[model samples]
Target chain A: EAGVAQSPRYKIIEKRQSVAFWCNPISGHATLYWYQQILGQGPKLLIQFQNNGVVDDSQLPKDRFSAERLKGVDSTLKIQPAKLEDSAVYLCASVTSPAADTQYFGPGTRLTVL
Target chain B: DQQVKQNSPSLSVQEGRISILNCDYTNSMFDYFLWYKKYPAEGPTFLISISSIKDKNEDGRFTVFLNKSAKHLSLHIVPSQPGDSAVYFCAARADDYKLSFGAGTTVTVRA
Candidate 1:
């Protein structure tokens, strides 16, 4: 079975610019998640989706950050007017179901905002 | 507020020795505890986990100990190998389906 896949291993953008990241989760996986990991920090949950519907997104920055899991197989996370503080590695993860204990993670997209 | 915390920023251990990483949680409601090992440029992988009802769980060379009363847990790696050198993250999950993570501890196994 294939693990979670993410696009654009690395990205660089200027402050106030917009950036987007994509994620394709493992087959048969019913839950997907997006996380942000700042340097020297662990991954922090940004949003979660279960079968095309959002399960939780309380930590997401509604003013500038948004994500969607249309069709429930692939997902995308976008940040508009990115700020310097947004420079971090964005990770995508998945689990077979919401009740599963183990989560498979993707390589992640390292975003650097200038 | 960060619910999980790994106070040690880093640890250096000689090969064939034991490596112990500690984590503390502020929330007592977490149902499961897990540890993840991450390499540079790669995402984290599950190492070992312990449920809230269990005090200890072991797999191969890794063992996880949970102390519910103190809201603390630990991971012990015996006979550490070079491949074991990586950042270790302690995470907790509740019924809300959210995994709260700590600021990982980097462990370097020396030969």
Candidate 2:
């Protein structure tokens, strides 16, 4: 019954530097997601993976952000040439399946780009 | 261009009183709505959910009401407790698997 796990609960990087966040979803979960949450706003979906395959990434900024899930169990989100606007919390979540609506979230990596 | 919006940035209610949080969505295709509660430094946790077909769903002291015609939804917590203080996010899902979320409302339950 362990929940989603994320690494480096907090991160700091300079503008134009690269940063990466990691996520390990609940065991047996079939769907994983990455989200960005700016201050005062809710988490915004960045990308979704359905068992090592992308389900949706329309909102992802391909020019700077990318994510991948290997073996459908763990995921990593990367931001290259980070901008000041990228100073926000990067959250990782997972759902049991496409039929399930309940999403379990991790503590999130708070990225501060200076 | 935000599809879901929670207008209230924060709310304060006395313990044992009622706390009501409102949310509005612009999309007509959204059929499933959910509420999540989050504490500082922690990710959001699923609180309650209501499908479009139903007007109200209740779990213990928490209730969610959805108005399809107005594209509005609300969460109500009765006899609010100090532990209930947290940010609450409203989210909606359309035909697709993605969910649209609103800027959350922070609720403070004063003892």
Candidate 3:
């Protein structure tokens, strides 16, 4: 089976600029997720979508970050007014369902904010 | 605070030797634990998993042991191979299906 797919394997932006990352999950998967991985740290959950509906986004910084899944197949994560601290890899993952344990991950978009 | 932690940042072992990586979790509510392997420039791939009810699960040359009372778990790779060199992440899952991950352990298998 084809794995999750993401765009712009790498990105660079200046502080105060906006950036967006895209993700296309595995076909037939019902759950999608966005995560942020800073250097030396593991992936941290940013938001979760269950068939285009948000299931969890408590850890997301609403003031700067937002994410959406359309048609339950593709997703986009956006960061406005990017800061230096926003320099990290944005990873997208998917699972067969919300209750499924094994998650498939994409190559990720490495965002560098200068 | 991170609920899951891999205290050892890195480990080096000779090929054909045993490699053991450890992880500790702070939450008792976590009912499932998983291990993921990652290479440079690539996303993590699922390696193995164990449920709360089981104390040990083994697959081929890999084995995972969970100690509920100690809130600790470990992954053992026997006869490590050069291809096994990668970052290993330990993750815990709650009933909500959200996962908490560790910083990861970088294992280097030397020839």
Candidate 4:
């Protein structure tokens, strides 16, 4: 079976610019997630969606970051007025069920803000 | 306050030897633990997982041991191969569906 898919494997933008990342979860998956991984650190959960509804986004930066999964199959994460500290790999993952423990991850979009 | 921690930044082991990675967690609510392996440019792939009720789980060459009393867990790769070299991350999950991850440990299997 195909795994989670993400667009624009890499991205570069200047500080204060805006950037967006896309994710397509595995077929029939019910849960999707977005995470940020800074250098030398593990992925940090940014947001989570169960179907078209958000399950958790407490860690998301409301002032600068936003995400949506309109149809429950694909999702997008956006960062406006990007900061230098936002230069990190944005990862997308999905699971077959909310109770399932394993999460399949995508290659991730490596964003570099200069 | 980091809930999960992988204290060793990296580890090196010879091929045919054993590679052990350790992780600790401060949260008692975490009932499920998992280990993921990641290459340089790709995302992490699930390796093995052990529930809190079980002290050990093994699959092929990889094994995971959990100690609920100490709030510690470990991953063991026997007869380490070059292909096993990668960053290893330990994650803990509760019923809330949120996963807390460690900083990760880089393992280098030498031939």
| Leading candidate by lDDT | 3
lDDT per residue (tens digit) for residues B5-86 in model 4: 9999999999999999999999999999999999988989999999998999999999999999999999999989999999
B61-82 in candidate 3: lDDT tens per residue?
A: 8999999999999999998999
Better of 1 and 4 by DockQ: 1
Please count the clashing residue pairs in each candidate, in the order shown.
0, 0, 0, 0
TM-score of each: 0.98, 0.98, 0.99, 0.99
Q: Which stretches of candidate 1 lie over 4 Å from their true place?
A: none
Candidate 1 Cα lDDT to native: 0.95
Listed per model, the TM-scores of chain A against the true chain A are: 0.98, 0.97, 0.97, 0.98
- Model 4: residues >4 Å from true position, as ranges? none
How do the residues B1-111 of candidate 1 rate in per-residue lDDT, one tens digit apiece? Answer: 889999999999999999999999999889899999999999999999999999999999999999999999999999899999999999999987689999999999999
Which clashing pairs does model 2 show?
none
Model 3 has an lDDT value of: 0.96
The TM-score that candidate 4 achieves is 0.99
- What CAPRI grade goes to candidate 1? high
Q: What is candidate 3's CA lDDT for residue A2?
A: 87
Q: Write the per-residue lDDT of candidate 3 for residues A40-110, one digit (tens) a residue.
A: 99999999999999999999999999998878899999999899999999999999997886999999999
Q: Which pairs of residues clash in candidate 3, taking residues 3 or more apart in a chain or in different chains?
A: none
Per-candidate DockQ versus the true complex? 0.88, 0.84, 0.90, 0.87
- Could you tell which candidate, 2 or 3, scores higher by lDDT? 3
Query: What is each predicted model's overall lDDT from 0 to 1?
Result: 0.95, 0.94, 0.96, 0.95
